[model samples]
Every structure is written in structure tokens, then in C-alpha cells.
Target: MASFRVKGGLKLKGEIIPQGAKNEALQVICAVLLSPEDITIDKIPDIRDVNKLIELLSDMGVTVRKNGPESYTFNAAAIDLDFLETQDFLDKASALRGSVMILGPLLARFGTGKLSKPGGDKIGRRRMDTHFTGFQKLGATFRYDKKKEIYHIDGSDLRGCYMLLDEASVTGTANIIMAAVMAKGKTTIYNAACEPYIQQLCGMLNRMGAKISGVGSNLLQIEGVGYLAGTTHTLLPDMIEIGSFIGLAAMTQSEITIKQVQADKLGIIPEIFRRMGIKLDIIGDDIHVPSQKHYEIETFIDGSILTIADAIWPGFTPDLLSIVLVTATQAKGTVLVHQKMFESRLFFVDKLIDMGAQIILCDPHRATVIGLDRKYPLRGIRMTSPDIRAGVALLIAAMSAEGTSVIDNVEQIDRGYQFIDKRLNALGASIERID
Candidate 1:
């Protein structure tokens, strides 16, 4: 196992480029299975999750070749559906949440799919009922083997149908769209996730000859086509990573510029950060965080304490709530953070509290953070990463703390951020990789 030893109290300076969106890349790679020709994807992140998904695809007989750094050519014309039932495939599929996306394309093209229970951060119970319910609406039958923890889906000639999902799940929305794209008729999905990742999936499918409307709205309409052609696509920049960088700059009192940031795609993120008294300058496609003069939490309209929370697309992302919470610890005032989507995500505040942060965990979904305002910067301390978002949050806290801090089980962080230590080092962050 590898770990990160960071000496905090150093300001990060210079420019850093954000990596490709990991969530979007995973869905896009699986979409390749819908086409017979070669599909090339550029700007793919070199992270463990992406690597694991690629390995699963290769095991299914998809031809995945590295064309260049962060580029790949995939041909799923020879995919073997039988491989989906193997023990090796089950083990890998159960390791990442993104693996559930392959179910739609596999079922669409081959009429059946067998998958294990998908795994990811243990923040909450992310049910697949929405996914299966949507599939059932389109003429798919599901059989569950509780003892073996396997899901068997069987369908013939999926016909388009209107589906109203219980919630706006990002991966679940992507899966429904993939299955609907090759169905027999028109399919309408309500309460669909319209995040940038979902938008990118729709755009990529459109380029490959699938007709999908309402790209950035909660309602999606997909016109079924007999076949989709192979196409080349590039992924959007990782908004989560971009948010992390913003928090990093704020906490460390650094002035760093991010290149190629899709400013418009980051809906309400900058404005939310602005509420924390963090000023950002957007020069064209770049985001510049100037050196901090002061960090103060702005009050709400009624002069009440501001509360920041996460929601579906066009709202703040749940994935970045941890980073936001950590950044707020160094601000000048108090803010309420509500993480309604996940229960265990807010539990990581215990580590920050140990580092001299003033936080009150009100419940599983809420916390009150009183900032130290640079008067008492966090003291360096050792901690273990429990999950991906928490790992990044702890890293940001460690970077802004005094002295040295060690973060163990860094592989969790590696699953999301690509070359995090190297990228932060380029911006003058004193973080070293240790084994």
C-alpha cells in the first residue's frame, strides 16, 4: 500500500490542468459496446477505476488499445457475453460503482446481462432498483440470486417506454439511456440526472447516430435506432477535481490558475464558493484563484447563517461536499453543511475535528463548521482514508495544516484523482508519495 506524507502550511502557486471526468469516461467507454466499429476516446484519466473498467472490457473480448497518453481505441465488436458471469468479472464488477453502467449496453446488444452487486464508497445504500425498474419499463425482466449476490436480466426487443425514476441517479440515468438508445421506439425518462457527465454521454451517443433530446434537463427523450456507429469523443474536464483545486487554493492561501475549465458547465459551484468569501476570476476557459486576503462565510438573505448543500445536476454535487466542508474549516465564520444524499460521508469530520477544527456533527446528514480564520490553522496529524471524497478532503486538510501529516490507504484516493501528488507538486505543494 502507498501513502502521502504532506508538510502543510505551504501556499500552492502556478498552473494546473484538470483531468478528464472519471464518471463520464466510464460511461463513454461502455457506450462503445453499442457500436461495431472502432471508437476512440481522448483525454481519459489514468486512474485505478478507469484501468479496472478497461480490464473488464478487455476480458469481455473488447479490443482496447492505447493510442497515446490518455487516449484509447476500443472495438467491442467481438465482446463475449459469457464472460460477464465469470468469477473474475464478478469480483471486478463488485469493486466499482461505474461497473453497473455496462449492464445497459450489454443487455441492449446481447439481450441479457449478468452482474454482481456493484461496490463503491460506503456512504449510503445506493439502490439499483431505479435502474432495474427503468429496464423493466422497457420490457426487461430481472431475477436476483440473493445467495450469490448476482443480478440476471433477460429481455427480447426492448421497446421504448416512459419511465419516472424515484430519484435523479447519475449512473442509473446513464444506464437507462444506453438501453433506450437501441430499443424499438421512443423512450422518455423523467427525473433524469442532467449533470455534465450525463450530458456528455448523451452527446457522445448523438455523435454515434442516437437521437437524444433534452440534453441538460431533468426530462430526456431518446429515439431508438437499430444500430449506432463508432465515433471519436473527448470527455469533459473533471468538475470534482476542479472543485478540489478551488478548495486547495482557498485553504492554503494560494494563487493557482486552472486551465481548460468549462466555466459554464460548473453550474452553481463558483457561486457556492463565492458564498464562502472565496473570490475567483474566470479568464475565458481558465479559473484563477487569487491569494486569500480573508475567508468569511457570507450570511443568507435573511441575515441568517448560510447553509450549503448538494443536490442533483444544476445544483452543487454531492461528491464535492466533503471538500467544501473541509475548506469551510479555514474560513472566518460558520456555515451549515447538509449532505442529504449520503449518510456516512459527513462522518469523516471526526478526523478534521482531531486536527483542531471546530465542527459539530448534528446528524448523519448535517454538520456545523466554525472556521478558524487562519488564527489557528490545523495541526498536522496522521489519519486513514475511508473513501474517495473523504480521502481528498483529508489531503486538502493536511495540505493546509501545520507540520507533517501522513495519509494511509491512499489507493482510495488513486481510484478517483489522476496523478494527484504529481499535479499538486507542480503547483508547489509539498506532498511526497511513500510506500
Candidate 2:
């Protein structure tokens, strides 16, 4: 029940390096269960969710050794399969949504996997049908125990098959790929999620001797292998954090340099911020966001209002829409933010509204923000963080507001961003963690 007391109206300067991708770390860490050899991973973000997954792995008898501050070597040589059925395992696995991924590798290698109902941000209804459905398509028997709220999967004779996914779910696709890699034949997955995280997972699987093609597209082809070897993988910089920093710079009128952001992989994020008139300079791998008093939102060619919507990869990411909505509050014009994936994510706008930002929560899925244009600076107020993204969004709004703001439930923010208050404080912003 910690809180953040943020002093507003501070101009941040200096450089901040984005941490390793949180999403990718979850998938690849679960992939360690696919092999019993040593797998060294670098650039791991020290965050709550990722650390929970790592702790889950350690509890499952995976030999986890810290090589450095951001590196670990995992060897799943002597996994205790009986642990999955224990109450302790259920308690730990139920707390992390990423724990669902472990079922795939366990089923692939040991032919049995059990998972308690996974938990994560309460943004909306995140169905597990995609993950289980993909497993069933790959010859796994699925059963849900309603009394205990646990999922049971057994795949003794897995074979390759072609299937069209009902939705392009990133974690679903990753889970299925991990299962299919050790199947008997080739598997083709259409309408798959091709985000950088998935691509990185596929690339790591390839390096580990699994055959996968179509790295950056919706269609993925995998040839089953008998066993996978160990390999080293370095995760990409978290794009969500980079986008948040960009929004923080614009909202607070600060000049900040984000170092080694792997800009090429940040599809449409930069342009989407630029559409809101945020100036970004891409020098090598770093993104330089300059200070600006006012940035104007761009409209369509036919004179319609600018719409920033989320899509699959190569489109705007839904994770950053919260940041966009908060950033647009201080812009020169209006922008419509459409958060299509999650229904309840835009609910945080009510907090920003309390901070003196003009926002119309049209519905659960869309919000229209009329920029105050610095004529009316937002005045800080007490608020509560709803989710990871929204929490960061509120932090940004508080940083650009006129007074001190107390944000409760900052644990939600820490789940994604590693030491966010400390990092931003180094850039000259004032954020104090109150325990």
C-alpha cells in the first residue's frame, strides 16, 4: 500500500535508459522449461511481474543464478513436476498472468501441466481461451476444474497441425509456439501476433535449435524438433517505457534523451507521438525529446479530428494510449484516443479530469482530449493508480501539474516500470515513495 508524492511543474533533464522488455522476459523465461541446458538471459528488467515469474521458476527447481545486475543463467535440469500440483505452486502461479506460459513448456516436455487461474491488471476481460484453445489444437487435452479454478493440460502425443487463430494474441501465440516446437511434425499458425516480443521469442527458439520461419509477420511456420539446446538472449528495450518517457517530456516541457531505445522496433510509436506534435530526434539508437511549451495535434487531410487508435503490430500500441491521452491534455489541439483492445483502461481519465485536464470519456473504449495549450496548467490533486499504464499516465499528469499530488497504489506502477520514481528523480523530477 505504498504511495507516490509527486511535486509537479518540474522540468526534467539528462538521459534515461529504458529497461529490458517486460513482456519478452516473461515468454523467454518460460521457454527455459523447454530445455534442461543452461540459458543465459541479459538485460532483464528488475520489475515486480518479471521478478515474480523468475521466483516461480526458482520454486519449480529451475537453477537460477544471477550473473550480473541485469543477467541470469537458468537451467531447468531437475524440475520437480510434482510441485505444479501443490498448494504453494497454486498460490504463486495464481498471482501472475505470465504463469500461464509455463503450461506450454511443461506439456511439451513432461506431457502434463497444471495452472491455477492466473491474475494480472484488471483492465478488462482477458480470456485464457486463446491459450488453451491453441493447446487443444496441438493435441493437448484441456479440462478446467471449476471448483478449484485450475486448468489441466496433458499432451502425451503432440503432433503438428495447421490452425487459424480466432485472435492474434501475443501470449497465446508464444505459448502455442513453445508447445509446437517439440511436436512430431510441422505446425503452421496463421493470424499470429508478430510484435517484437514474439519475434524475439521465435529468434531465441531458433537459436536453441527449433525451426521457425516468418519472424515478423502474421504467418508462422514451425518444424517440430525432438529437443532444444540452451542459448543466450538479450531482450529489447521496453517500448512502452520509451513511449511513456516521450509523453513525460512533452507533458512537463522537458528535454530528455532516452538512450539505446532500439528505435526501429518501436513501430509507429514515434510517429504517433509526432502526430501529437511531439518533436523527437532519432540519433543512432537514442530518442531525443525536446522541450516545447505547446504542441499541436495533427488532423486528417480531409479536416477530420486526429484519431490515435491501437492496432496489432506496425500500428499504435494500446499500452501507450494512456500516455497519449495524458500527453494530449497539454497539447495545442484535440485528439481522439481509441483504446480498442481493453474496455476499462480509459477509466483513468477521470483522475486526470480532477487534475484540471479537459477530457471527455466518450465511453469505455474512447476518450476525446481538448488540450489546455498551457493557458490553463493542470493543478495536481490526490488520485489512485488503476493499472500499470494508467498509473504511469497519472504520474506524468502530476509531474506537469501545478502542485504536489499524492498517488496511492503505486505498487501497480512498480509492476511494470523498474524504479520509476528513482529514475525520473535522477532527471530532476521530484517523486517520493511513501511506504
Candidate 3:
């Protein structure tokens, strides 16, 4: 059990480089299993989730080599299929939701796959039906072992087919694509997620001999190939971390530059922060946010209070809603933080309220925040991080408060952000990790 002791009221300065995307790394690493050849990946974020997946791969007999601090070479040429049926593999698979992605690659290369009920943050009901349904659509026979809580999928006779997904599930879309790429014929997926990560995965698959089109659209087409070749891939910057940095600068009145953001891919994130009256400069690929004594939240064109809500890609991301909520606490006006995707994410607002933030927890999905406008500084207090996003939000609040605050169960934070305390400390913020 680790904890973070954050000293508040310090203005951070200097530049901080964002790590490679955690979400993308998880998918790309699992995709390595689709080929018998070696695949080299760069810009891999050093975080808990990714390391856990890599450990799982190593345990399954994949040859994982460290090319550099942020690079690796994975050769799945001699994977042990028998390991999938063991209790150790099941327990490891159940530790993170990203482990579910390995099923698609395993089924694609070996004709069979097994998955335990995936585990992740307790934010909402994340159903795996979409992933299973997509597999079944591609001619894979799927079944659930009720007593063991395992899903079994066989892809020995898989053939490409049409699938209209119920929603734009990101992981589900990636999983199905990995499975469909090696099927017998053409496969078309409608209502597919078009996030940058998905596009990158599609591009990588194409480079590795898979035929996939419609890179940035809701409809994707794939022509099955016999086997994929090993190829190198570099992950995109972590957009979620960029959003968190933006909110951190605003809440703490800091002048921080976030480096290597690749601005165009950020979509609506910068604008969402600007709507909260946070001034940001897009200097090349870096985001420079200057110190602010006061900032105001904007209203709608019809004079209604602004509302920040999450949606699929091209819309606000649900991962940063907690950051936006905590950032709005010090802004001039009020904004409604609506977390439409997750039910339990907003429950952490109670900790912010105890820290002197003015937030009304309307329900599981929405909260109305009345900005304190810097009239009264938040008082630091102790808290437990419930999930990854909420954990980061609590850290932001603690950093902007009036005294030292301790955040326990910080493993939740480590799972996503890499060396968060050290990185922020380099910019002059005081965050100490306590074991």
C-alpha cells in the first residue's frame, strides 16, 4: 500500500513530457500475439497496467525483451497454450480489463482463446457482451463456463462477416478487428469506434499484412489474410494525461508546458478546458498554460450554465470528467459535470467537498459545481483514491489546496500515470510517495 503526500499551494513551472498512451499500449501489446514473428514497439509508457500485460505475456511463453526504457521486442513464436487453462493465468487475467484483449489475438493465431471475467476500475457496468458478440459474428463459437466464470472462444473455422455493433465500444472494436484480420473473407464492421488509437491499430495491422480500410470512420472494412508479420509500432501520446496536465495547471495557477502532445489528435480536450476559461497556447506540439490568478467558466449561447459531459470520440472523454469537475471548483462560474458513461465515478466528489469544494452530487451521473472563485482556498485532507481518473482528480485537488494532503491506495494512480509524483515534482510541485 503506497500513498502520496502532496504539499499544496505551490506554482509549478517548466516543461513536462507526456507518456505514450496507456489505452493504446494495452491494445498494441496484445496484438503482438497475432503474429509468430517478433514485433518491436516504441514509446511504450512505463506503467502498471502495461507492465502487468507484459508480465502476462512473458508468463504465457512470449519472448519479451527490453529494447530500451520505453521500447520492447515481443516474439510470440512459442507461446504455451496450455497455460491458459491454469488457475495462475486465470487470476492474472482477472486483474485488469486489458487482459480481455489477448483473447482476440490468441484466437486469431491459435484457433482458440480463453478469458476470465475482466477486472478494471469500478466505475460502471462495462459489459463484455459486445466483444463476445463480435467474435460470434465472425464465425467463432463462443461459450461461457458458469462455474469458473470463464469465456471460451474457438476460431478454427472463422470467416469474415458483417457486424453492426450496438455501440462504439473501443476495446470491443479492436478485439474484433484482430480476430477478423485472419478470417477467410471480407469483414465489415459498422458503428465502430474511430478514435485515434483505433486508427493507429488499423494502420499497424495493415503494415503487418492485414487489409483494413476506413481508418477514421465509423465503418471499417477488412479483408482477411492468412497470417500477419511482425512489425514495429510507436504509440501516440497519452491524451488523458494531457487533459489531466491542463487541469492541474489551471487549478494550481501554474505556468506549465506539456510537451509532445500532437495537438491535432487532442480533438475537443483543449477547447473543453478553454470553455472553462483556462488560457492555453498551442505552440507547435506543446501546450503552454500560464499562471492564472482567476479564471471564469463560460455560459451557453442562451445564457444557460455550461455543462461538461462525456461522449464517444470527437466528444469530451469520460476519463477527464473528474479533472474537469475539480478544475471547475476554482473557476469563476458554475458548470455541470455530467459523467454520462459511468455511474460511480462521481462518488469521489464527497472528498472534494471535504476539501472545501462546492459541489452538489445530483446523482451517480451528474454533479453541479459552484466555483469558489478563489475566495476561499481548499483545505487539504486525507482521502483514498477510488479509481484511476478519480485518483488523479484527487491529486489535483490536493495539489491546489492550502496544506499537506495524503492520498492512500495510490496504486490506483500508478496503474495509469507513470512516475506522476516525480514528473510533477520536476515542475516545482511537491508530491512525495510514502510506502
Candidate 4:
């Protein structure tokens, strides 16, 4: 277990570039299996989950080559179908939630896909019904082994059909799109997830010979093609990480510039921070957050308490709710953070309460933060990270708190952010990684 010894109350300065989008990286990397041709991806973040997926592909006989520090060329022409039955595959696939995505491409191209029950952040019950349900709609046979906790799907003669999704799940939509691209007929998907990452995947698929329309809308149409060719794709900057940096700047009263943020794709993230009283300027593609001693939360036009909730894209992202909750601690006035997607994400508030933030755990789904206005600064304390988002939130809290704080299980943070400590240290924050 790795821990971070963070010295609190240091104001960070200079610029930080957000890494490649982790969510998009997971989806696109899995898409490489859709074609046997060479697929080169640039801006691949060097994080644990993405690296694990790459390794999984390599173990399955996909030839992978490093083109640069953050570039890779993958050729999946010689995949070993039998490897899916191995215990090694079972163990590895069971550990990553993203591994479930490989199912669509494998079933589409090779007619069969096998996977163990996937694991990821212990936030709540992340159901796979959407994925399997979409597959079944596309003429795939689905089976689950309760005893082994494994999933099996067969798409020997996949025929596309129109379907309305139960939820606009990003991964679910991506999986179904990948499968339908090579099906026998046209597939129309209503209520599809239209996030930027999903659009990127759809665009890349189109560039690779897929007949997809409605790239940035809730409705998607796909015409089955005989084959797909490989193409080079570059991932967008992680919006979640950019949001985190914005919160970090405000919490510590730092002047930090986040560069090449792809501002248009951020979708209300900047406005969400502005509502929290953080002053941020969008200069070209960079977000410049100036130093602030005090920022006040905004109320609704009707003068009601401001509530920040997560919904599907175009709404605020649920991934940054933890950062919002932590950032609201030192601001003026109050805000309610409603984490609609995950039930257990708000449980980390107790740790922030321990650090002197006035937060009411309204329930499993909501938290109300009464800002201290920086009058009562948080005091550092030893704590353990429960998940990636909460871990980074706690690190932000500790950075703005008085004295030093020790955060255990920093591997959670490492899974998302690349060289976080070193990057923040360059901007004048004091953080030491202890093994």
C-alpha cells in the first residue's frame, strides 16, 4: 500500500496539462480488437487501469508497440481465442471493469467472448445488464455462470435491430455500437449516451470504415459493414482531471493554468466551478484559475439553496462531484451535492468532516456542505482512500488544510492520474510518495 505525505497550505503556481481521458482510453483501447489492422492511439495516459487493459490485449496475442511516451500501435490480427479459457485471463479480466468492453469486439469479429465478473471502484452496484441486454438485442446469445461468476456471449450470426436502451450508459452504448458496426443490417439506438468520449469513439469507428451517424446526439444509426480498417486516433484531455485541478486551485488559493483543456468538450464543468465562487478564465484552450481568498456559492434564481447534481452528459459529471464537495468546504455559503448515479460516493464526507469541514450526510445519495469561508481551516489527519475520485478529493482537502496529512492507499489515485505528485510538486505543492 502506497501513501502520500502531503504538506498542507502551500499555494501551487504554474501550469499543469491534464492527461489523456481515462474513460475514453478504456473504451477506444478495447475497440482495437474490432480490427486486425494496425491501430495507433496517441495521448495514452500511463495509468494502471489503461496499462492493465493493454497488457490483457497483449496476453490475448495482440501485438503492441510503443511509439512514444504516450503513443502505442496495436495489431490484433492474431488474437488467441483459446486464451479466454485460461485461469490467467479469468484473474486478469475479473480485476478490471473496463475488460467487459472487450466482449463486444471479440463477439463481433470472432463470434465468441468470455469474461469473468469485472471489478472496479467499490462505489456501488454497477450493473452489466445494459451491456448484455444490448448484446441480446443484436442477436447474441448470453449466459452467466453463477458458480464461477463468468459471462459468455456468442454472436455467430449477428443481425442488427432497433432498440431503446434502458439507460444511456456510456460503456453500454459503446459496446453495442462496436457490435452493431459489423452486424448484418441497420441498427438504430435511441437514448444512447452522447458524451464527448462516446462521440470520439463513434468518430473513430466511422474513420475506420463504420457507417455511423448522429455522432453527438442521443440517437445513433449504424449500418453493418463487412470489415473495419485501422486508423490513428488521439484522445481528448481528461475533463475530470481538469475539473480536479480547478478545485485544487481554489481550495489552496493557487493561481494555476490548466493547458490544452479542449474547453468546448468540458460541457458545463467551468460553469459549475464558477457557481461555487471560483474565478476561472477561459483563454483560448486554457483555463486560468486565479488565486482567491474567498469565493461564495451561488443560489438559484428563486433564492433557493444551490444544489449541484449529476446527470447524463450536458449535465455536470458525477466523477467531479467529490471534488465539488471538497471545494465547497472553504467557500462562502453552502451547496448540496447530490450524487445520483452512485450510492456510496458520498460516504467519504466523514473524512472531510474529520478535517473540520461542516458537511451533512443527508443520505447515501446527497451531502450538504456548509462552507467555513476559510475562517476555520481544516487540520490535517491520517486517512485511507476509499476510491479514486474520493482519494483525489481527500488529497485536495489535505493540501488546503493546516499542517501535514498522511493519505494511505494512494494507488487508487495513481489508477487515474499520471505522476500526480510530481506534477503538483512542480507547481509548488509539497507531496511525498511513501511506499
TM-scores of the models, in the given order?
0.99, 0.99, 0.99, 0.99
- Residues 1-435, candidate 4, lDDT per residue (tens digit)? 999999999999999999999999999999999998999999999999999999999999999999999999999999999999999999999989999999889988998999999999999999998899999999999788999998888899889899999999999999999999999999999999999999999999999999999889999999999899999999999999999999999999999999999999999999999999999999999999999999999999998999999999889999999999999999999999999999999999999999999999999999999999999999999999999999999999999999999999999999999999999999999999999
Q: Give the per-residue lDDT digits (tens) of candidate 3, residues 260-328.
A: 999999999999999999999999999999999999999999999999999999888899999999999
Root mean square deviation (Cα) for candidate 3: 0.7
Q: Write the per-residue lDDT of candidate 2 for residues 131-181, one digit (tens) a residue.
A: 888889999998889999988888998889998999999999999999999
Alpha-carbon local distance difference test for all models: 0.92, 0.95, 0.94, 0.96
For candidate 4, the TM-score is: 0.99
TM-score of 3: 0.99
Stretches > 4 Å off in candidate 2 = none
Checking candidate 3 for backbone clashes, the offending pairs are none
> How much lDDT does candidate 4 score?
0.96
Better of 1 and 4 by TM-score: 4
lDDT of 4 at 58: 99
Off by over 4 Å in 3: none
lDDT for position 120 in model 1: 87
Residue 108 of model 1 has an lDDT of 84
